[model samples]
Target: MRSEFCNALVGRSGNENVLFMTGDLGYMALEPLQEALGERFINAGVAEQNMISVAAALSRQGFEVWAYSIAPFCYARPFEQIRNDIAFNDLPVKLVGNGGGYAYGVMGPSHHAIEDYGVLLTLPNMRVYAPVFNEDISAVVNCLSSELRPSYLRLGRGEAPDGYVIPQYAAWRQLTYGDGIVIIAVGPLASTYIGAFEKLPKTQRPNLWAVAQMPISANPLPSELLSQISSAPALCVAEEHVKRGGFASELALYLAEGGKMPKQFRHHYALAHTYGTYGSQQFLRSLSALDEGTLLSTIAEFAPTSV
Candidate 1:
C-alpha cells in the first residue's frame, strides 16, 4: 500500500498543494515518497497528535495534507485531535494507519492495532478504508485524493498468495460460489483461506468473499454481492478485529436493518483481550481466535463433513 501511495504522490509531482507528514514511523516504505516529495514530506517526530493537528492546519490553507503512522498510535494518541481538528472541522486531512492488525508482531500489544476500524468508523464523516488485495491500494488512495473529507486508511504489509490477483477496487471481492454457507473474510485474512480453501473439493467449498471498505462509506454490501452467497444456510464472518464493534457487528446491524439477514449468522474475531505474547503474525493469529485452523474449525461446526 505504501508503494501505491508513493506512486500516487509521484503521479502528482508538480502539485505543490500535496503535503505528507509522518510521526517518525515511515521507515523504508515512505522514503521514496519523501525523496520524491522533498520539503513537502515532513517528519513530525514521534508526535502523532501534533502531526494530525498540523495536517489539519495545512489542509485549512488549501493544501492536501496526509498524516501517516502506525495504526495504534495514529488513532489512540490523537483520538481527540482527530475528532476535533479534522473530522469535527470537516478538514480533508487523510490519516493513513500502516501495520494494521498484528502487523507489528513482536512489538507487543501497544503496536498491534486491532480496534482501528471500529473506532474510526464510529467517527462522524471519517471515511475508513481497508484494502484486502495489494493491487487495490492505489485505487483506494486515489479515490480518497479526489474527495475532500476526513479519511482513515487501514493498511496491511501486503502479503498475498503467489498467483491469484484482483483488479478494480470494489467494496468487496467474491472468492467462491456456494449455496450452503458463506464465509466473509476481512482484510488480509482473505488471503489465508485463499490457499487452503482451494484444497477442498468443489462441492465442499463455501462461497468466500473479502469485504475491506468500511460499510459506513460503501453504505451496504452491493445488492449483487448479497444476492450471490447470502442465500447460504449460514453467514460466517472472519475478522482480525474484536467481535463487538468491528466489521461483523456493523454487518449484523446492516443485515437486520435492511431485512436481509441470512438464515444463520456466526462471527470469529480477535479475542477481546491484550495479546501479551509477541511473535510472528502467524503465531499471534494462532493465539487469537483468527488463526486459519480456528477459523476453519469454527465454520466446520456449522457445515457438513464436506467442509
Candidate 2:
C-alpha cells in the first residue's frame, strides 16, 4: 500500500504542487518518491514533531504535503504538533501513518496505536480516514487530493479484508440491509462481520455498514443511513480498537441525540482498560476478545426480538 501511495504521488510530478515528506523511515519503499520528486520529498529523520511542523509550514505556502511514519510515532508522540501546527491552522497536510492498532502486534504497546482514532477525533479540524481494503485506499488517496483541510489516513500493516468494492470515496458504505439489527464495523474488521454474516441463515442476518472513512470533523452518519439503522430493533458496533471514544462510542452518541434508541446497543471492541504483552495480532485479538468468535457470540447474545 505504501508503494501504491508513493507511485500515485510520483505520477503527479510536473504539477509541481505535491510534496511528500517522511521521518527517514520509508528508506526501502519510498526510494522512488525521493528519486522522482527529490526537491519535494524531505527525509526529516526520526523527529515526528519536526516533520509535522515542516509539513504544516509547507502547506501554509500552498504546497500539498504528506507526512508519513508509524501510527504511534506519527500521531501519539507528536500530538501537540498536529493539534497546534496543522489542525489549528487548518493546513492541507496529509498525515499518513502505517501499522494501526495491533497491526504492529508483536511490537508491543509502545508501537501499538490503539488510541490513535480516539486522539485524532478529539482534534477540532483533523479529519480521519481508515480504509478497509486496497480499493478503498485508492479511493481515499483520490479523495484526499481534493480535500482542503488537514486529514489523517491510517493504513494497516497486512493485506486489507475484502468487504465491498467502494467506487467512490464516501464517508461510509452499507454492505448489507436488514430490519432486525444493525451492525457498524470499522476498517478491516468489517470483514469479520461479513464472516459472521455468512454463519447466519439468510433470514437471521442483520443490516451491516462498512465505514471507509471515519472523519472527526465530518459527521459520517448520513440522515438516510441513520434512518435505516434507526428502524432496526438493535445496534452493534465492532472494531479492533478500544471501546472508549472510538467508532462505537461516537455512533452511540449520535443515536442518542437522534432519539432513536435500539432495544439493545452493544460495543464489541478492544477493552480500553488493558494492554496486553507482545504477541501476534491474532493472539492479541483473541486475548482482547476482538476476534470473530467473540463477535459472533456477542451478536447471538444480542439477537433482537420484534418490538
Candidate 3:
C-alpha cells in the first residue's frame, strides 16, 4: 500500500503541496517513495505523537499531508494529538496506518491494531478506509487528492490483491444476488472468505459484499450500506479484528439504536481475547478460529433464522 501511495505521489508531482512523513518504520517499502519525492518524504524517527503534531501544522499551511507508521503507532500512540490537532481543527491531514488487523501477527498484542476503527470512528469528521484490492489504492490516494477533511487509511501487509475489481462503495459491490443471506467481508478477510466459500455448494451460498470503506458520519451509522443489506434474509459480518466495537458491533449498534435491527444476524471475527501467541498471519487467524475450516463448519450448521 505504501508503494501505491508513493506511485500516486509521483503521479501528482506537479502538486507541490503534497508531503509525506514516516515514524521511523517502513524501511523496506518506503525507500522508493523517498527516492522519488526527495525532501518531500520525511522520517520522524519513531516519535509518533510529534509526527501527528507536525502533520497537522503542515496542513494548516495549506499543504496536503499524510503521516505513515505501523498500525499501533500511527493512530494509537498519537491519539490525543490527532483528536485535537487534526479532527477538532478540521485539518486536511491524512493518516496512513500500515500493518493493520493482525498484519504484524508475530509482534503480539502491543503491535495489534484491532481497536483502531472504533477509536478513530468516534472522532468528528474523520473518514476511515481499508482496501480489499490493489485497485482500491487508487480510490484511497484519490481520497488524499480530494478529501476536504481528516481521513485515515487502514492497510494490510504485503501486496495481495482481492482478485476482483474494487467498487467505490461496499453496498454497490454486491458479489452475488440472493435473499438467503448477506456475507460482508472487510479488509484482507475478503480473500479468506472468498476462498472458503468456494467449498460450499451453490445451494447454500449466501449473498456477498466486499466492504472497502467505513461509512461513518456524525450519526456513526452505515445507513446507506444497510439499505442494500436489508434485501437479504440474514446478514453476517467478517473482520480480522475482534467483535467488540469492530464492524459487526458497529453495525448492530447502529441498527438497534435506529430501531431497524436485523432479526437473523451472524458474524465471524477474532475472539474477544487473544492467547498472545505468535506466528504468521494465517496461523494466528487459525488459532482464533477465523480460518476457512471454521467458516465451512459454520455454514454447514447455519440454521438461517426466519426473522
Candidate 4:
C-alpha cells in the first residue's frame, strides 16, 4: 500500500508539487520516493516532531507534503506538533502512519499505537482514515489529493483483510442494513463484523454500516443516514483501538446530541491503557478480545432483543 501511495503521488499531474518526508525510516521501500522526487522528499533523521512542523511549513508554501513514520512516532510522540503545526495551521499535510494498533506485534508496547485515534481525533482540522483493504487505501489517497485540510491515514503492517472492495476515490460506503440494531464497524474490524454477521441467521443480522474514513468534523455524518441508525432498538460500535475518543465514543456522543439513545450499546475495543512487552499481533488481539470468537460472542450477547 505504501508503494502504491508513492507511485500514485508520483504520477499525479502536479507531481512536482508533491513533497514526501520521513523520520529516516522506510529505508528499504522508500528509496524510489527519494530518488525520483529528490527535491520533494526529505529524510528528517528520527525527528518526528520537527518533521511534522517542517511538513506544515512546506504545505503553506504550496507543496502537498506527506509525512511518514511508524504509528507511535507519527502521532503519539509528536501529538503537540500535529496539533499546533498541521491542525492549527490547517495545512494540506497527509500523515501516512504505518502499523496502527497492534500491527507492530513483537515491536512491543512502545511501538504499538493503540491510542493514536484517541489522540488524533482531538486535534481540530484533522481528518482520520483507516482503509480496510487495498481498494480503500487507493480511495483515501485520491480523496486526500484534493482535500485542503490536514489528514491522517492509519495503515496496517501486512495485507489487509478482504471483505469490502471500496471504489477508487469513494469516501465512504455502506455494507449492510437492518432495522432492529445498527452496528458501526470501522477499519479491518469491519471484515470481522462481516464474519459475525454470517454467524447469525439472515433474519437476525442487524443493520450494519462500514465507514472506512471517519472525518474529524463531527457534523458531516449524513442526517438521513444517522436518523436511520439512531432509530434502531440498539447500537454497537466496534473498532481495533481503545474505547475512549475512538469510533464508539465519538458515535455515542453524536447519538446523545441527537436525543436518540439506543436501549443497549457496546464499545468493543482494546484495554491497553498501560504499556506491555513485545508479542505477536494475534496474541495481543486475543488478549484484548479482538479475535473472531470473542467478537462473535460479544455481538451475540448484545444483539438487541437478546439483551
Candidate 5:
C-alpha cells in the first residue's frame, strides 16, 4: 500500500501545485515520487511538526500539499500543528501516514499508529481515510484531491481476493453478503477477515463489509449497511486500531442511539497496550486475538449454525 501511495503521488505530480513532503522517511518506496515531483518533493528532515506547518502554509497559498511520514510521526508527533495550522484553519493539506496500526511491528509502540485516526478525528474539520485494499489507493487519492479540507490517509496492508471485483470505493461497502452474523472490518484489517472467512461454509458465512473513510457523518453510512446490521442475528467489528473512537465504538454509538443493537455483538481490536513485549504485527495481533485463526473461531461461534 505504501508503494501504491507513492505511485499515486507520482501519477499526480504533473500538477505543479501538488507537492509531497516527507519527514526524512520513505527511503526506497518513495523514489518514484521524488524523481517525478523533482523540486516539488521536499524532505523536511525529521521534524514532523515543522513538516506539517510547511504543508499547511503551502496549502494556504493555494497549493495541494501532502505531509508524509510514518503513522505515528504524521499524526501523534505533529498533532499540535495538525490541529492548529491545518485542521483548525480547514486547510486542504493531506497527511499521508504509512504503516498504520502495528504495521511497523518489532519497531515497537513508538511506530504503531493504533490511536492515530482516533486522535485526528477529534478535529472537527479533519477527514480520516483508511483504504481497505491496495486497489483503493487511486480512488482515495482522487477523492482527497477533490476535497478542500484537512485529511489523513492511513496506508496499511490490504488486497482483494483473487478475481473478486471490489465495488467503487465508498465509506461503507459490502464485500460479501450472507445471512447470520454481519462482519465489519475497518481499514486494512479487512484483509484478515477476507482470508479467514473462506473457511466457513457459504450457508454460515456472515455478510462482510469494509469501512474506508472516517467521521462517518461526513459521508453517512449507506442504508444497505444499516439494514444489514439491523437484520443480522449477530454483529462483529474488527480493526487494527483500539476500540475507542474507532469504527466499532462509533457504530455502537449509532446503534445504541437508534435502539438497534443486535442479539450478539463482538469487537476484535488491538487490546490493552503492550508495555513490555514486541514482535511482528501478526504476533501482536494474535495476542489481541485479532488473527485469522481467532477470527475464524469467532465466526464459527457467532454463526447461526455449525459450519
Candidate 6:
C-alpha cells in the first residue's frame, strides 16, 4: 500500500501546488517522490505535531498539503493541531497514515492505530478513507487530491485474488452476491474475507462487499447494499479497528436510523484483549477473530440449514 501510494504521489508530480511532507519516516520508499517532487517534498524530522501545523498552514495558504507518517504519529500524536488548524478551518490537508491497524505488529499499542478513523471523524469537516485493495489507492489519492475537507488516508496492504478484476474504486463495492448472509469487510480486511470466500463452496459463500469511505452517509444509500442487507438473513461487519465509533458502529447506527436493520448482525473487530499482547498482524487478527479461519467458521453459522 505504501509503494502504491508513493506511485500515486509521483503521478501527481506535475501539480506545483501539491506538497508531500513526512515526519522523518519513509527512508527508502520516498526517494522517488522526493526526486519527482523536488523541493515540494519535505522531511519534517521527528516532529509530527510541528509537521501537521506546518502542513495546515500550507493548506491555508492555498497549497495542497499531504502530511505522511505512521498511523498514530499522523493523527493521534498531533490531534489537537489537526482539529483546530485543519478541521476547524476546513482546510484541504490530506493526511497519509501508513501501517494502519496492527500493521506494525509487535510494536505494541503505541504504534497501532485501531481507533484512527473513529477519532478523526469526530472532528468537523474531516473525511476518513481506508482503501480496500492496491488498485483502490490511485482512486483514493485522486479523491483526496480534490477533497475540500481535512482528510485521512489509512494505508494497509491489500491485493485482489488472481484473475478477479476489481471495478473502479467507489465508496461501496459489492465484491460478490449470495443469498444467506451479507458480509461487509472494511479496508484491507476485505482481503481476508476474499480469501475466505475463495475457500468456501458457492452454496456456503455470503454476499460480500467492501467499504472504503467512513462516517456513514445513508442519504439515498446505495440501492444494491440496501437490497443485500434488506434480504439477507444475517449481516456481518469485518474490520481491523475496534468496534466503537468505527465502521461497524457507524453502519449499524445508519441502518437502524433508516429502518433497514438486519435480523442477525455480528461485528468482528480487533479486541481489547490483544491490546496487551504483541505478535504479527496475522497472529493478532486470529486473536481478535478477524482472520480468514475465524471468518470461515463464523460464516458457516449463517449458512442455510440442510433441508
Report lDDT (CA) for all predictions. Answer: 0.78, 0.75, 0.73, 0.72, 0.85, 0.87
- List runs of model 3 lying over 4 Å from the truth: 157-172, 177-179, 218-233, 272-274, 303-307
User: On residues 1-307, what C-alpha lDDT tens digit does candidate 6 reach at each position?
Assistant: 9999999999999999989999989988989999999999999999998999999999999999999999999999999999989999999999989999889888788888898998899898788899989888999999999998889999998888887788789888878755658888888888666755866677778878888887776223488888878887789999888888888888888889889999899999988634556898888988899998887777889888889
lDDT of 2 at 183: 79
Q: Which stretch of 10 consecutive residues in model 5 shows the poorest summed lDDT?
A: 191-200
RMSD of each: 2.1, 2.7, 3.3, 3.0, 1.7, 1.5
TM-score of 2: 0.89
Residues 1-307, candidate 4: write the lDDT tens digits: 6676666666663568888889888867777767788767789988998999999899999988889998889998888889998898888899988877788788778878787877887788777878765555655678888878888888873243355444343344455554446677667556555655654665457666666676525325555557766566567776778877788787777668877677778776877835455478777877877776776676566555644
Candidate that scores best on TM-score: 6
Give per-model TM-scores. Answer: 0.93, 0.89, 0.87, 0.87, 0.95, 0.96
- The alpha-carbon deviation from the true structure for residue 51 of candidate 1, after best TM-score superposition, in angstroms, is 1.1
Candidate 1 lDDT tens digits, 1-307: 6677677777775788889888997787777788878999899998888898999999999898888888888998899899988888889888888888888778778888888888877777777778887777777878778767788888885456677665457777776664446888887777787776666655556678887777544556766667854566688888888877899898888888878889888887877436555687777778877776776675566566643
Query: Which consecutive 10 residues in model 6 have the weakest lDDT in total?
Result: 214-223
Index of the highest-lDDT prediction: 6
Per-residue accuracy of model 5 over 109-206 as CA lDDT, tens digit each? 88998988888998978899999889899889999998878999999988777767778877788877566588888887876666557656776777
Model 2 lDDT per residue over 1-307, tens place: 6677767777775568888888877868888888888778788888898999999999999998889998888898889999999989988799988877777778777777787887887887677778765556666787887788888888873243355344344677776654446777777667555655655765557777778666523755766667766676667887777877788777777667768666678777765424536587777878778787876676666565448
Reference-based lDDT, residue 8, model 2? 74
Clashing pairs in 6: none
Can you list the residue pairs that collide in candidate 4? Answer: 178-207
Model 3 C-alpha lDDT versus the unseen true structure: 0.73
Cα-based lDDT at residue 266, candidate 4: 70
Q: How well does candidate 1 match the true structure in TM-score terms? A: 0.93
Off by over 4 Å in 5: 305-307
TM-score computed on alpha carbons, candidate 6: 0.96
Whole-model lDDT, model 1? 0.78
Candidate 3 lDDT by residue in tens digits, 1-307: 6677667767775677888899998777777778766888889887999999999999999988989888889999999999999999999898998877877888787787878887887788887778775556766688656888888888874233346443553322555443346677777667556554644556567556666667533324354457645655567777887777787777787778777776578888776436756787788778767776776655555535447
